[model samples]
Target: MTQHIQEAYGYIFEPKLIEDLCIVAAELDFKEGDQLIEIGQYIKKMPLLLNGVIKIMREDPDEGELLLYFIEKGDTCAMALTCCMGSSKSDIRAIAETDGTVLMVPIEKMEEWMTKYRSWRNFVINSYNNRLKEMLLAIDNLAFMKMEDRILNYLKEKSKLAANNTLNITHQEIANDLNTSRVVVSRILKKLENEKQIKLNRKSIDLAL
Candidate 1:
């Protein structure tokens, strides 16, 4: 656990902070598609990603789930941090995008480290700023981009997250993330394939652009 924390956050945290984290943080492993945090759930611990990707989502009563952004290795969810600081339930859902490990830091330590370590304070402020920017980008995509374009952008993001052009995902999964219908996703995907933007496979998409 000490070695893992050092490797993941040594540069961002002071040695004393890292040492304290290894003492208090609990290391956990997650498989792909695992739900780490859900809407209305009280956050007791904050997660620090050591490896892999995690997708943050927002829920709507009528539209289902909308993908907010993805957090990768060495990143922490600002939404989760907010909930921890405010002592409130989580409004966003966090799902593991791939098999990964994370260090769960107790909420009590969050405040202590803020004043105790300069690095921790900067990290928290930067996380909030970065996540806000991503949320704005998500809103922009929804408000301005066409459906086909949105689908293409979504695929491109997934491709980058997966570190491969070939994505092992389905139309329904894309629909769920984008908060659309599977039929609509399939139709737009087909259109994209026709436009030579992507190649459609049985349960996957090979991005060409």
Candidate 2:
């Protein structure tokens, strides 16, 4: 666990900060599909990912849920940082996209480290900036891009996160993530397949690009 922390998050913090984190941080392992945070729940700790992928999502009563962004190895969730900084409850959810490990710093430690460690402040700022950029890109895609382009971009991102050109996902799953109808998703996927952009099979999509 110590080695994993050093390898994943060590460079982001000063040696003393890293040492202090390791002393207080508890290691947690999550399997695929595990929920890291739930909507409307209070967050107690912040996670520093050691390995694997986490999917951040926004939930709504009428619209359901949508994929917001992905947190991968050596990354931290910006939402987690915000929730941990205050008494507010979580407005989003985080799920383990793959089996992974994380070093969780207690909420108290996170606040303390902000003032006690320069690296922590930098990490927090950079993480927030990166997440904001990702969210803005998502909004831009929704506003300026056509559905076909959006679908393609979504597939590309999924492939990247899974580290493979072939994705083991269903059309309905894609629809849910994009907050569209399954029929629409299937039609678009078929069009992409006809154009040789992707190949579709039972519950899978193979990128031709």
Candidate 3:
């Protein structure tokens, strides 16, 4: 556990703070598609990613869900930090993008560490800033980018996260994440394939660009 903490966050957190985290943090393992946090659920623990990826999403009562951003190893959810600070319910859903491990730190320790450790405070602030930027990028994509461009960018991001050009994902999954229809996704994907940007496969896509 200590080694995991060191590997994930040693540079961001001081040795003393890391030791404290190791003492209080509970290790959790999650599989792909596991719902780590849900909308309207009260947050009890803040997740610090140890390995793999987690996708944060926002729900719309009428439009379904939109993917906000992806948090990978050494990252923490800024929205989760906000909920922890306010003692509020989660407005976003957090799902495991891959089989991963995380350290679940008690909410009470959030404030305590903020006051006690400068590194923790800095990390919290930086996380909030980073997440805000990602949210803005998501908004920009939705408001300005064409569906095809958005789909390509989304695939590129997924590919980068998976560290592979080929992605084992379906059109429906892409539609859900992008908050669009499967028909639209399929059409755009076909266009992309025709343009030699990506190769369509059975339940997978191979990037050519």
Candidate 4:
């Protein structure tokens, strides 16, 4: 597990929700470029990243492509509760941006806990709080940061989450993630390289920070 997870959700390890639920927490590992999930797949479980990084991206069937936004370690893969009420707002593709490890919790187990135990609500509350905090942070960045600043911040955040000063991200994917053009992303990357802030290659970045 990354140190950030302990810093973020220390409550998950407490003895609170262990009684009624069969906690199937395990350290699952994956390599870079691996697809942990595909678009439109039924998200029957929530995944908690224990280490490394993952991105939650949306595919455009109309445009014939995808846009990527990172979900770092300690973020949940499935926003089940929100979509449980209606036609899913977003189709998620979980990309293992770097090697990753995660803990899986099936929704059925959580449902059982919700029915049988009052304390199970704590987990749900915590999950929503964390997700909301991330969403708000995303909004703040989009509103306040320039395009370059957004890219810089994104790389820096992913670098830290990746447990290294290097980032494994595709420029095209980042462009899609930031809602910018690919050529613009390439130009920004060049600027970052000239400034000695990062070294960009075909599929990854060596972040100087």
Candidate 5:
């Protein structure tokens, strides 16, 4: 219904395919804190985020939750290969980190579309590969890199993407993305601030050179 939805749909499929896909896709409005999928549930469809942000997180009883990524409007959430492997895998869950709407499209239809549309098929393949590579790279960085190096690298990359150095991010949020404790993140940030690398503040951080 939103302009972005229409635009993204156009990129993924022809108008008629979108119409057919919509026939099978179910729309759901979720409130904050809603669990769209539970880890280990029989996930049969990919949900297209229509509104709001959802965090795809895996929890650690000891370290807390590790955030994989946030799925915003026009993003898709589904663990396809995990489903194909077997039901032994934990059912992936999409938590409404904030309230959102989703279009649940059956996996079968997605496969059908991939077969019918070369461009869309390539897009899905690339997306899956990219996500996998990002996950692997994150793990490698965490395992081999020093704390200060990682923090500085994170700031540099974020600063580049962000228009200015004043990236509106919280220490807690950074820790979740980095797969570490807030205490560790705060400690590193404090060190960086003392060295004039960044200015820390309540609710957000200002990037410093």
Candidate 6:
């Protein structure tokens, strides 16, 4: 565990802080589709992703859910950090997008590291900035981008995160993420297919663009 943290996240903290993390960090593995954190649940630990992808989503009463952003290898959840600081529960949901491992640090350690280690403080600030940027991008797409353009951007982003142009997702699932009806998603997808931007299978989309 110590060696793994040193190799993957060593640069984020000083040697002593790293040693402290090694002593307290708990490793957890999650299968695809597993919920790591759910809305309104208290966060007991802060997770540092080591491998695979976790999708952070915001749920809506009428819209179901909207994809906010993704946290991949070597990233931390800014929402979880927020919960650790003062919030009692989480407002967003985090689900494992693929089989992955994460190092969970107890919430109590957060303030200690922040005060004791300058690097840790910097890491936390950087994480918040990155998350804020991604969230703003999501907002821009939802508010300003056309539906077709938004779908295209969604496909491109998912392809990159999956590390393949081939996407194993259903149209209905896409509709749910985009907060639109499946019929609308299908029509737009068909248009994209006619333009040769994507090749559609029963439950998958292969991007040609």
Best by lDDT: 3
lDDT of 1 by residue, 100-158 (tens): 99889999899998898999999999999999999999999999999999999999999
lDDT of all predictions, in order shown?
A: 0.93, 0.89, 0.96, 0.66, 0.70, 0.90
Q: Is candidate 1 or candidate 6 better by TM-score?
A: 1
Query: Cα deviation of 43 in candidate 3 (Å)?
Result: 0.2
Q: Give the per-residue lDDT of model 4 (tens digit) for 1-209.
A: 33434543555644444422223544568998898877666655566666677776666666544434566655664454445324364366677877867666666666666666554556567767776676677778767878888889887876666677866678887787777788999999999899999997777799885
The candidate 1 region of ten consecutive residues with least summed lDDT is 1-10
Task: Give the lowest summed-lDDT range of ten residues in model 4.
Answer: 14-23
Model 5 bad stretches (over 4 Å) = 2-4, 31-34, 61-63, 78-91, 97-99, 152-170
List candidate 3 stretches off by more than 4 Å. Answer: none
What C-alpha lDDT, on a 0 to 100 scale, does residue 186 get in candidate 3?
A: 98
lDDT of 6 by residue, 99-150 (tens): 9899999888988888989998999999999999999999999899999999
lDDT of 6: 0.90
Q: What is the lDDT of residue 81 in candidate 5?
A: 36
Clash tally for model 5:
3
Q: Highest TM-score among the candidates is held by which one?
A: 3
Candidate 5 vs. true structure, TM-score = 0.74
After TM-score superposition, what is the CA distance of residue 195 in candidate 4 from its true location, in Å? 3.9
Poorest 10 consecutive residues of model 3 by lDDT? 80-89
Q: Tell me which residue pairs clash in candidate 6.
A: none
Off by over 4 Å in 6: none
Give per-residue lDDT, candidate 4, residue 114.
66
The estimated TM-scores of all candidates read 0.97, 0.96, 0.98, 0.70, 0.74, 0.95
Please give the clash total of every predicted structure, in order: 0, 0, 0, 0, 3, 0
